[model samples]
Target: MNSALTPDAVVAAERWTAHNYHPLPVVISEAEGAWVTDIDGNRYLDCLAGYSALNFGHRHPQLIAAAHAQLDRLTLTSRAFVHDQFAEFCHRLADLTGQDLVLPMNTGAEAVETAIKVARKWGYRVKGVKPGQAKIIVAADNFHGRTTTIVSFSTDPDAHDDYGPYTPGFQIVPYGNLSAIAEAIDQNTVAVLLEPIQGEAGVVVPPAGYLTGVSRLCSENDVLFLADEIQSGLGRTGETFAVDYEGVQPDMHILGKALGGGIVPVSAVAARRDVLGVLQPGQHGSTFGGNPLACAVGIEVIKLLEKGEYQQRSAELGQRLHAGLETLVGQGITALRGRGLWAGVDIDPAVMTGRRASEALMERGILAKDTHGATLRLAPPLVITADEIDYALDQLKAVLG
Candidate 1:
C-alpha cells in the first residue's frame, strides 16, 4: 500500500466505494496461517476465516505460491477458448468431488445460479417437466446468495423485502424436517436444495440422520438433491464435505469460498455428467470461470485437502473446542450447536446477546462474528493449532467473565 494507505485509508476508500457489507471494525493489514495483523499492528486469532473462505487459513503459502507461479505464466484466457488449466481443474475438481463433471464459476452465487439452470434443464429433458413449470424446494432461513434469482426464494424479510416481482416456482419448507421437505415436493418439483448444515443460520446442525433421510427421500421421490456446501465444505466441518459426516451425497454440489484457497474467486458446481451436462455450449458461461490463476490455486487447494491431515485436525480440534465451550453452558450461555470447527454458541439473553459477545471477543483479541440476535459463531481456520485454540478460548473466557 501507499504511505497514505493506513487502515483508516482503506476504510475511507470503502466508504465511497460500496456500502454493501457491514464488516467488523478491525482493519486487517496482513495475515498468515490462522492469525491476522491489523493496521495498528495488533494481531488477533481469526475465528471467522472470512466466513469459511479461509479454511486453509489466510495467505496460505502453498496457495500463494501457486497463484504467484500461475500469474507469471497466465491469468485469464476466458472460457470461450480452452486454456491448458481449465481441463485439469475440471478433471481434478470432478475427481475430488466424486462427480462425473464440473461446471466452473467465479463466485458462490453464480454456482447456485448454474445449479438452478442445470436442475431445470435436467427436469425438462430427463424428468420431462414442461418449460417454465419446474419448481425447486428451498428451506426457510436459507442463505444461498444475494443474487436476485437466488433471493426470490428467501423466507427472510431482510433478504426479500422490496426485492419484488420476484422469481416464482420455488417452494419453502422447514429446515431439518425430512417430512416437511418430502411433503413440499410435488410433480412440478425438480430438485430439493438445502445446506447440509445451515452455516449462516447460526451454524444450525440438523437432527441426526436428516441428511441420509433427505437423500433417501429424494432418491425414492425421483427429485434431485442439491447441496450448497459453499460455506460448509472443504474440511471446514471436519469432512471433505459436510455431507460426508453422514455419508450422504447430493445430486449436485455447489462449492466456492475455500476452493480458491482464499487467494481468488473460484467456485463451481460438481455433478454427474447426466446432471451437470444439462448446460450446452451456448447456454451459459463466465469470462473468468476457469482462468489459469484460479485453477492453479484450486489445484493446490485439493492437494492440501488430499494431504489427509487437515480434516482430521479439524475433527479433533472441534471436539476440544466444543468440550471447552460446553463447560460454559451454565455459566452464561443458552445453548451451543455445530459440527467440526464450526460452532454457534447461544449467549443467554439475560447475560448477553450475540452482538455484545462479538464486541467483547474483539476487545479480547479474539475475533468472531454474531449471527441472528444471540448466537456467536466461532469458525476458525482448519489449520489452527491446539495452542491457537487454547489462546482463543482463554480470550473467550476472559471476555465472558
Candidate 2:
C-alpha cells in the first residue's frame, strides 16, 4: 500500500478523477454500522447512507461475512457459464418481490436500463407497437439514472447538459398528477416509469391516492407501470416499498441501493415472466451480472431484510424522527416533507442556505448534504438506533441555531 496515496487521497482523487460530482471534502477511511471515520480518525454519523445504499449500515457483519466466504470459493464465472449462487439470488429476489422473474444487474443504473429494455421489447412484441416508435412516459422531476437513454428524458438540465443526440420515444408528465399521466398516453406509449417518492427532488411525497390512481389508469390504458424504487425501496420509506403505502402493485420494479447491504453493487429488475421474457438469448446481458460474489452478498441482504424486522424499525423510527423534526418547525425551518426515515428539511433564508447548513453540520461532525438551494435531505441508515437519531437531531439543532 502507498502511504502517500493514503494521506492526500482526496486531493489525489480530485486531480485524477473526472470532475463529475461536487462532493463534500470529506476523506472517509473506515466505517462500521452507522458511523464513519475520516482519514484523520474523526467520527461522524452517516446520515446519507450512500444515498440509501447502506440501509443495513456500513460493513454489516452478515454482508461482510458473505462477501468473505464467496471471495474464497468463487467470484466471477461470467454469464458464459452458470454459477451456483446465481439461482438462489434470482429465486429469492423474485420471491421477495412477488414477481415471477428477476434479471440481475451490478448497479442501480443497470437495473434501470434493464427495465427500459424490457418495457421497450414488450411494447413491440406484446403490445404490437412498431419497433422504432415505441414510447415510454416518465414523470417530471424524475431521477432514474445517468445513462444516455436515461438522461435523455431527465428534466434536469444539469444531467442532460451537452449530451445529445438524446434517445427518442419518451414523454414527460407532471409528477403526482394522475390526469397529466392519463393525458400523456397515446397508442405508442408502452410504459409509465416513476419514482413513488422523488427522493432526489427532496423526498417529495405525492398526494394521496396518486399511485393507485396511476396504477388503475395504466391498467385501463395497457401501459406497463414501472416503479423506480432504487432510492425509495428496500425499507427506506418505512415500508418495504413506497408503493406499499398505497397498496399499489407496479408491473415492473427497478430496485437497487440497499439490495447490496452496503457490501457490494447488486441490483435487479423484477417483473412477471411474460414482461421480462421478451429478451431472447442475445438480447440483454452484463458480464458481471449475477456473478457469484454479488449474488452471495445480495442473497444475504435479502435474507436480513426479510428475516429481521428492518421495515418495521424504519416505520416506527420514521415516526419518531419526523416528530422530532416537526418540533423544529417555525424555528429555522421553512418546510419539511418525507416518508419513513427520509426527510427533506427546508431552511429559512434568513437562517442559512442549504449548502451553508451542510457545511456547518460537517464542521459539527454530522454528515448531511443539500438537495436544492434551501433543502437538505436526511436519509440515515435504517439500522440507526433511537439514541443515534436524537444525537443527529441535536447536531442539526445546534448547527441550525
Q: Write the per-residue lDDT of candidate 1 for residues 125-153, one digit (tens) a residue.
A: 99999889999999988999988998999
Off by over 4 Å in 2: 1-9
C-alpha lDDT (0 to 100) for residue 124 of candidate 2: 93
**Mind sharing the TM-score for model 1?**
0.96
- Cα lDDT for residue 23, model 2? 77
Count of clashing pairs, candidate 2: 0
State how far residue 268 of model 1 sits from its true place (Å).
0.5
Question: Which residue pairs of candidate 1 clash?
Answer: none
| 10 residues in a row with least lDDT, candidate 1 | 1-10
What lDDT score is found at residue 398 in candidate 2? 88
Q: Give the residue spans of candidate 1 off by over 4 A.
A: 1-14
lDDT of each model, Cα atoms only? 0.88, 0.90
Candidate 2 lDDT score at position 21: 84
